[model samples]
Target: MMPRPPAPAARPRRMVSAFTGLDVCETAGLRLAPGAARVLFEQDRWVFAALIDAHRMVLDRELIWEFAEILNPCWRTVAKEILLALLAPQHEAVLECAHAIRSVRSPRTCFRFLQQFTDWFNWLTDQGVTRLDDVTQHMCERYLEERHWSVPVPGEPRRRLEPDTMAEVVRAMQLPVLYGELLSRDGCTEGFAPWEGKSASAVVGLKKGGPNRVPAVPDLVLQPLLATCLYLVNVVGPHVADLLDVVRAEADSGQDLPRVTKERVPAVREVLARLRAAGEPLPALSTDVVGRRVGRYGADPLTHLAWGRLARMAGASVFNEYAREQVLPEVQELAAEVGIERPWARQAALIAQADSGEQVPWTDPVGDEDLQLMANYVVTACLVLTSALSGMRTSELLELSVGCRQSRSVPGGGIRYGLAGRLIKGKRFGGVPDEWVVIEQVDRAVALAERLVRRPQGAPLFGSVGLSDRVKNLRGWLERTGNREHWGLPVIPQGPTSPRMLRRTLALSIAERPGGLLAAKIALKHISVATAEGYAARPGGSQRLFHAEMHAAEEEHHMKLTLQAFRDAQAGIMPAGPGARGLIDALRHVDAQLNEAARTDPKVLTDDRHLESLLRKLAKALHVGPANFCWFRDPSKALCLRLAGTPDATRPLVGLCDSARCPQATHHRSQRPVWIGTITTIDALLDSPRVAKGEKTRLVPERDRALRVVAEIDAAASTAPAGKD
Candidate 1:
């Protein structure tokens, strides 16, 4: 003011431009004059409002500030402050670059920096990092290095990048120092100490000259890994599409992905089945068979062995391991005692060699004494193997019902029941009925199933009849009932049995048996021959014959006896006569006593209390007591003897009544009433010389009538009042 601004310092007239000339005002449709500029500025603020609206769509809202810095360098200080406050240090560099591009007076300088910044931004976006702070310098460096790295060229002596010039151009750009810092933080630095000096090129192993090679995996290990993957995919259940994509990618890229055919699956199954059957630990067959069957596909024994090992490692069963360890040793011992060469001795030795730690083979033989102890186990195993070998599952075994039978229509003869089974393995197959089958083990299983049937239609054949406690205790019972040596059977394996393994072993056995192929297929209810064929190829077929013979006769006898006893009980309770009358009368008397006591002393009349009291009295009286009522009627004498065979038989009967107002009262009148009767016909029958002449005969009806009259009188006296008019 003092200087008067020196005539406004010869001020040049300020240029008046259209608001549209300014990008911000142009975007907002506003004017540039001071008065109108305020309104235009406010209108331009709506752009920020629109950004807020678009926030969700933008992966990184921080990028908007950088964009702002690039568009208006005069706002660089504001943008820098906003970026520093909003983002990490790495992001600040990006914003600075953007600001430099916008602020540069030369158009060429501005264009060059803009191009560099844009390219860097696009790369960060591709890496899923939106903020400059999020994209580490190390990552950017590694990315550029990856792009430039030369790969081995097939049929060429030297290596080269696919696009040779592209890497050089990218490397020439002046990338910010923060790029390297970010990369170092992310552990992407070339020759990083922790990375063992592996540059990006070295890590990827890109070279120029040789054919593209894939790594190889041992077949044994590969099979199990593949099987495990399959199990995880199929049994555990996961995203199939995602898993398949991964597998497909890995396979196409020649990664060590597992490959298995349908044939190989069964072979693997057989190996696992054998290990399970033996109840042994898995062996390392992968090392032995890796290169033997590289391209060929079928049942690979080595693959099977490897799978078994994997299955065990995956916690298949401890009992399985115990079985394997115990079975072979026992078998060798038995073979030596019996002077027979161990047929599977080499197999046993292989197992021993392959065993790590306490793993051993079980080889004890079945004995007669252990038969009952291991009956359920043996029977269940046989049934399961029979089905598995035939290709049947547990569900099918459970679905069997009574009357689900096959009948053979004999030509010009009556239909005979051949075999009976409900839906087996979810399929229907007509065959010989279990009753007709000569195999005792099978018959026992069938009988058990029949016995457990609750409905006429069907019943759950296994684990339906008994309590879990009882089933669990079956192992302990086996231990006590059988010799220790008998616990180890080549087929049965040592240790506790599970329903699952039993079924598997059964399948195996059926597969190995002669004519077992068809029989197993029918038993398992399989739709395809191939499915059943897997079971038939198991190792323990010959053992089944022994099982069948060992159990058939004894189980049949036990079953017969059990049925006979049940029928006898039923028949015995059906007859009506004096015997039935006596039992009914005794029960009625006990009930009356109980009811009276309950009425008098409610607290004292629990079921246990009454039962205990009644049992004690009855036991004392039966063993040693005053003979009171003679319930036993002597048919020869036709006498209902009261106080039978007692010295007081002829004494005057004492009638103690309950009612106080009775007229024929005596000293014992207050006492409760006890019935009075006499053996009137007994005196004459005993005194008669003719009857005593070493002869016995049924009494006449007159004598029976006389006894009946006395009994009726006694009953009346007990119920009616004394000296009734």
Candidate 2:
């Protein structure tokens, strides 16, 4: 009988405890051994456990080890220190410098800057510097001169610091210390060194205001400018290189309009030269000269002006009326040509006119009813709204599964929706399923999803219809329905605004709500809380929920009881049956071997022969056919395996005869199984040298046999089905 599969192997039983461990109470809490402490930590304070994990890298080793001996101490202290350092003025520059240094992928290059900063800090301390006041202009100049630092060269081997970086660093370093005082009246602290050779006032002046501000692009100007950029990206398309060459040629030629040519450099250069020259205190080249050049070239005046505007912008002209006018019309024409049918186009036209000295009416906020109507009228509105609300990119939103929900608890106690999304910006908020929105907004969306699952697998939940095509159809429908005029909000003329505004509005609104910017940032899915904090116009009430406040005490108690029940369900450690212990041990051994094999060469463990053998043995144990199994390829093989035989394993495991008729089964049909167990009663017929007496042999009851069969089937099928068949 195949040598009885090497007699299987004897399983080494693990000892389990029934008695409670001694708990030593201290000022903070009772402490237990590492294992018990872990259980306690996970049960009562998972957030603390998660915080410890997150800051494991920065935590002091000795303290961590001590905590590890009993309970994992909160790592919040290290995280707080890191945050404080980041916010400190002197450290802010160092952090920025560190970021810049780290941005260089090459280890050698990154190390150079790291060493430089370390040296700078050490030198400052050595000089007995105390407070921002001690840093001098001479010191700053000397540091720059010594380094011979140059501006960053984009996409090059040699990385250099930006020209403005030093000034920024100096300014950033001038802010007052966040925690430790650098220059006390009595003396400086050993670790706290102040800046040298500069007065407090000078440092204060540097830190008081924000960095040199770029002139704000007027709203009227911004619309036209954005439109122009889009128009250029679209119209020029593949010929952008050629267009750049043409502009460069014009700039070099120093003519009003260089002769149009296949070789476009001279024309481009000539145009750039004229634009730059115009910005300078150059005497006007008489109108006659301009006219002559225009006439000879047969060039359209408006086109030349548009091109000239583009060139001026390139040369960094802060303000130019001519450039503004030229850009708007070109953008408008391009929008029309590209078949971009949106109300924003009309807005763009109006904004352009306003920029060109035309008076316009300011529009009020679009009403909710109007927005709802717009949603019905324009299909794009839904796309935009979904994108905004979900903080997903247009592409990502389009790809979203209908099953997505709003909330979920991660491995840690961290929550993943609402404020988290606001903070992170564009990415999906965790701790929530995607289905949350569908459940909340429109119940039909979920029904539709269920229907679609039967119709088509892996299709986008929102629209299986092609996006651009649907957009076009929706646009036509909106025009026919007359919803456009009905819902259209009269606002300042702007470029092609889409549902993106809704997302921004949502973000801003969330920021304005309780918890203010931080909450909004979390909702928007921003990466940094600080980034989110910046968006709030004013601080709002506390919106963040602590773990203790989340659930009712009764509910928490119920959960603990439920967890204990689950543990009890799986508590029995007896060997299942004859050879069961050996089989389990052998299976475990094989698993370990496979794991090691995977480490060495993943292909080895994946070999068809090894898999087929395992599957065959598994089939024999479960008494199931191999054809019943199917593996999915996309996400994970293990998950695919679990979903395969669900239909066949349901009834017997639940202790119901004909589970279809059982009320409990029906009630819990959709509810996931929490735990599964097999209870077997074994009887020894003979203890001595094999003499089977008639009285010694007891008949096994049909119920017991049936239960055993079901248990065996389940054991073979574990990890092969998510639910019973």
Best by lDDT: 1
Best by TM-score: 2
Cα lDDT of model 1 by residue, 1-725, tens digit: 45543221221211321121234423322234443323221121212222211111122332222333233332222222222212222233334333122221211222234444545445555666643334344775576665554565788665445543443234223232222222211212221221233333344354544422222222332232223222222221122222323433433554332333332444445544554566554433431243354556655333323333333332332224434443344434433333221111123211121113233432222222222223344333334423322223333344445554444454676443322432222111111212221222233334443432223654334433222233245334434534222322111122322334333344333323221222211332222233322224322332233234323422333333223222322333211222334433444566577678778875854434454454343222110001122122222221222324342343222232111211211111111122112244454675687794433244444345445444543443343344331
Tens-place lDDT digits, model 2, residues 481-529:
4422333422223233333332333333333222222211123233223
lDDT, each prediction: 0.32, 0.31
Provide the RMSD of all predictions against the true structure, rounded to 1 decimal: 36.3, 30.8
What lDDT score is found at residue 544 in candidate 1? 32
Residue 231 in candidate 2, Cα distance off native in Å: 19
lDDT, residue 497, candidate 2: 37
lDDT for model 2: 0.31
Off by over 4 Å in 2: 1-119, 122-137, 144-168, 171-420, 424-725
How many steric overlaps are in each model, in order?
46, 77
- Cα misplacement distance, residue 390 of candidate 1 (Å): 5.1
